[model samples]
Every structure is written in C-alpha cells, then in structure tokens.
Target: MAETVSHHLGKGRLVAVEGSLQISKSEKDGRTYTNPQVIANEVRFLDWPKDSKKGNGQSAGYDDDNFDVPF
Candidate 1:
C-alpha cells in the first residue's frame, strides 16, 4: 500500500508521515557540498475542509454547471 501523510485539519498539527527525504547537493570545481541541504519537510492540509461531501467519491454523470447537452 502507498504511504500516507495527514496533518491536523484544525490546529495544523502533524498526524502521520511516511516517506524518504533527499537532501540537496551542489557541485563546484568537481567538488560537492551538502551543508545547506534540506533536512526535513512537512506536509499539511489547510485548504481542504474537515468535512467533505458524502458520496461514492465519483464524479456525477452530469455537467449541469459545466456545459449544456450537445444535441
């Protein structure tokens, strides 16, 4: 199963995180440096509401708002 990460939909707290982190690297004069690389990252969900519409999670077979029936 694919890993999932979920943050607090309210107070913006971390709920879960599953993934590998990769740090950035730089090359200069055939040398590499990794001091200023990213150490960690956090995923958060803020825009999505806490309660979403209940349905089959599928798009309706109607375009009532998108367009009219092309007869």
Candidate 2:
C-alpha cells in the first residue's frame, strides 16, 4: 500500500517506501496492537534549490536537457 506521511514528504525530493503492518500480542495485558514498518526501495530527486550548494552541486528545478540515459 502507498501511504504518505507528513514528516516524510518534503520539497525538492521524492521518497518511496515499502513495508507491511506488524501485529503483536502482549503477554502481560493480552492486548493486540498493530504497527507500521517501512523500508526505502528507491529515491529519485525531482528538484532542488537554485542557491543550494549540495549533492553534486546540482541546482534546483527540473532540467531534462542535460539528462543522460544509459543503454
């Protein structure tokens, strides 16, 4: 399932996470609870700040002209 969390989503980047819900039963209270666990599968950068000097010195925004493809 694809779920979006406020803390995980941000500007200039995209995050793809995969995981499943974990169900556990407590021995003390005999109560059942569900927890969500996720792992990052892939990350693709969509944009960045123009003045930001970070990550290979690439500027912000989408630029397809300079994009390189490997066969």
Candidate 3:
C-alpha cells in the first residue's frame, strides 16, 4: 500500500533527516538491562538546495510533458 503526504516546499527550502544506532540501558528492580535501538536524532531544515528537482521539465522524476499538472 501507498500513502500520501502534503507539504509546502517553495523554491527555496531545506529538509534533512538524521538517524543513528546506539545502546539503551534500563533498570528494573535493581537489575540493569541493555538494548540496542535505531534512533532518529534530528530532522533539520537547514538551507535550500540548488536543485531538488531532477533534470528536464519533469519535477520529482515524473514526465510532465504528457499531462498538464496544476500546482
């Protein structure tokens, strides 16, 4: 299955995702346990990219020549 999300990204906008794997420790009843997990450290909106869209008239790697898209 597929899902859709709507967001406003103008000509100049930045987006980023950062994640890492680390060990997590927990204590229960004077006993300690360790678990490893993958974590998303940050999602940063730093700066705009010179080109987020790919080459040619199509944006997001879709062919815009065939159909007219209203945006």
- Clashing pairs counted in every model: 0, 1, 0
Candidate 1 structure quality by residue, lDDT tens digits, 1-71: 11332221346432333335566788999999875432224443323333435353322332224312221
TM-score winner, 1 or 3: 3
Better of 2 and 3 by lDDT: 3
lDDT of 2 by residue, 13-65 (tens): 54333434455544446766655444444333444434554465464333546
- Which model scores highest in TM-score? 2
What TM-score, computed on C-alpha atoms, does each candidate reach?
Answer: 0.23, 0.29, 0.26
Considering only N, C-alpha and C atoms within 3 Å, which residue pairs clash in candidate 2? 48-60
lDDT of 2: 0.41
Best by lDDT: 3
Q: Rank the candidates by TM-score, best first.
A: 2, 3, 1
Question: Tell me, what's the RMSD of every candidate?
Answer: 13.8, 8.9, 11.6
| lDDT to native, each model | 0.37, 0.41, 0.46
- For candidate 2, the per-residue lDDT at 34 reads 57
Candidate 1: segments with Cα more than 4 A from true spot: 1-14, 27-49, 55-71
Per-residue lDDT of candidate 3, residues 1-71 (tens digit): 00110232345555454668899899999999999875544544444334546544234523434222122
Between candidates 2 and 3, which one is better according to TM-score?
Answer: 2
